[model samples]
Target: MHDQPWTTAPLVAFDLEGSGSQDHEHEAILEVGVVPLVDGHPDIRNAYDSTVNPGRRIQRRPWSSPGLTNDVLGLAPRLDAIEPELAGRLNGTSIVGHNVNVDWRLLSPRCPGIRPASLIDTLKLARLIHRKAQPRTLTALLAYYELDDEVTELSGGQPHRALWDAVGAGLLLGALIRELPHGGSLTVTGLHTVAGVSLGDAEQTLPLF
Candidate 1:
């Protein structure tokens, strides 16, 4: 056999929820959640979550959201405090996420030291795996893979808790990776071409396997 491709890449399934809207650039990441994986299993010991104080006030734009506020982020840690740990975990790993690019923009500036060579996006993977799906959001995939029961209990009220969502993402990743042809061994350059991402690096793409 191919030795199961997902197990080939050292992946870190992650998610980032910004303080404001989903526009991302203007809306700073209030919380970041990471679930590191090695050899097809969740590396619970290495998992991490952090809350970033985006410096500017987290405005609750009524147009997009009504209940969201800065109060939800009051207890989260600032970016400076979380940088060391963030750099250590993300230094050289393949990132797998619902939409890896969105998480990248939220995470990159915080740690100038970390640059991942490979990225596997579950969103893009969904498209490659299923051609006729209506949409490929996290919820959609959860249902598509019959993982709805696994995550439905988590869907009522939690807006942006980092650790909570991180745990959930870890579970979802465990399920999602099974759907990929190569468990998770997709290249950053290849994903960029598939996702139309501008991976601005003049370096050769590394072998994720």
Candidate 2:
């Protein structure tokens, strides 16, 4: 098990905009954004964003509110085309995001060989820290921290874009880490334990690649 303190480790917070909620075999990833962190701080200069063609037309659903339309994706590269670059970014870094399981489900099958060193779900982190904070969505968490305006500025006043959400998720992770009660330092394994059995089996430390 990698036992590095999360505060000092290199991490990557990412977000995905997919065609739908359920991870059906046919469902496709529409957009992906990655923000790399050094010592728990976002390295915005190296952030990455890409639009992926799911090999099929995106079906619009009430629950799905993707910023990219099928027409936009028509000109984008396929998943296989960018898997090499994406894999390079994810490998050897601890992964962080809000409701990250959805992103993992959409990404792992596409990139069979990439495995993150660890994983942190900000949505789960928030629940563990502040259970009474109503509407624990990313938007709500940003608002809770008075960061909604800052996110708007970061994304050129846009929300739901993968890059924007990735940046926001990274910022939220930093804030949550700061909020941790002082004592022994926060480690990747410790955070995973707090995430509990409902997340997955305790022994499965590495994320689904």
Candidate 3:
């Protein structure tokens, strides 16, 4: 793998809280958080998070962490209302997240015009680094790296909230990058190759509006 630093480019790490997992059906995004990273560190002052009215009841899943509920999202603005700001955050930046495909599936339909230049899936990266580790969820990876303590000190101290997850993902990415063999850094193309997917290609395959 080429040892080019990926942080030289603008990176936006984001997360989406959705009503459910079945994006093809009634599932919709309930909240979104975006954190722009500068030279491999999150710029919290410019971070963005918003509760989105999913236009349907927010389904509670057994696997989902607690916090999001119909009551919490009842008064939130709809996706269309926040589309402008959300798009602005995503525009012209590489994307990063844990299991980011899920976020893209739910987000692309809502903001068709904003297509990321590339993507770095932390889920995939974690597996690549720690192939034998079981249950490679974000929480598990954070704990494995001994980064959970820092995450717990975050503003909300909650796990599944959009902003918290986004920040956690960014931190996890930094840790993973540092652990790269021989002090190596990943290029955008290198990340895409390892991820075996591209946000640009995924966006093109999206249903035409």
Candidate 4:
């Protein structure tokens, strides 16, 4: 799995909208989205997205989860109801997201037995590709690459939503993969030096081939 290039190995880009909490322990997932990548393109046809009822009121924050009211969230499935589907799509797949570990920290505990074969952090990739780029957030990075419109069209939803961010991360990944400094084709393992799961590991970029 480590040696497989993203162009060949399967990748599942995912995002989890949480209960507006910074601490993973307190962050209940409000929604989830996953889009598989094929040939460097997001296959939205097979995409999975749903609002998961947190079983409690989601604290309101400015722009946290726009238009998702308690009434709306209450009607959605609980995490346990969707656990199998989430694990089916995520486990053993190469996972991609802007700050992926954050999602993992929140997701892994709730969905036991869920794990990924590899992780790619587009936030780290953006810094490596464009050192002087400003505001490396997912929204900013998509705009930086001029991919915002396409991702928006593909997602058909606004930012901060799981599906929209999933599609954005999938597209952002394809763009970043093309701009990698490595010569010729690159493998999933090759991106680890700059886009490893943790911030500390991603900071150490020694030659690895």
Off by over 4 Å in 3: 1-4, 22-24, 200-209
Instruction: Give per-model TM-scores.
Output: 0.70, 0.84, 0.86, 0.88
Please identify model 4 stretches exceeding 4 Å from their true place.
1-4, 22-24, 198-209
- Clashing residue pairs in all predictions, respectively, total 3, 0, 0, 0
Model 2 misplacement above 4 A: 1-5, 183-209
- Candidate 1 residue 204 C-alpha distance from true site, Å: 18
Using lDDT, give the best candidate's number: 4
Whole-model Cα lDDT of every candidate shown, in order? 0.58, 0.74, 0.75, 0.80
Clashing pairs in 3: none
lDDT of 1 by residue, 94-151 (tens): 7666766656655676566767766656667567667884556675566666755544
**Model 4 alpha-carbon miss at residue 8, Å:** 0.9
In model 4, pairs of residues that clash are none
Query: Which residue pairs come into collision in candidate 1?
Result: 6-182, 6-183, 6-184
The best-first sequence of candidates by TM-score reads 4, 3, 2, 1
Query: Over all chains combined, what TM-score does candidate 2 have?
Result: 0.84
Q: Determine the C-alpha RMSD for candidate 4 after optimal superposition of all C-alphas.
A: 5.5
lDDT of 4 by residue, 39-85 (tens): 87899999999998988887787857776789989999999999989
Writing each residue's lDDT as its tens digit, candidate 3 over 1-209 gives 23466777678889988765554545677888898988877777798988887777756778554667788788889898998898788877778899887788668867887777767788887787777746588888888888777766752546888888888888888888776673355775565666534665454543322
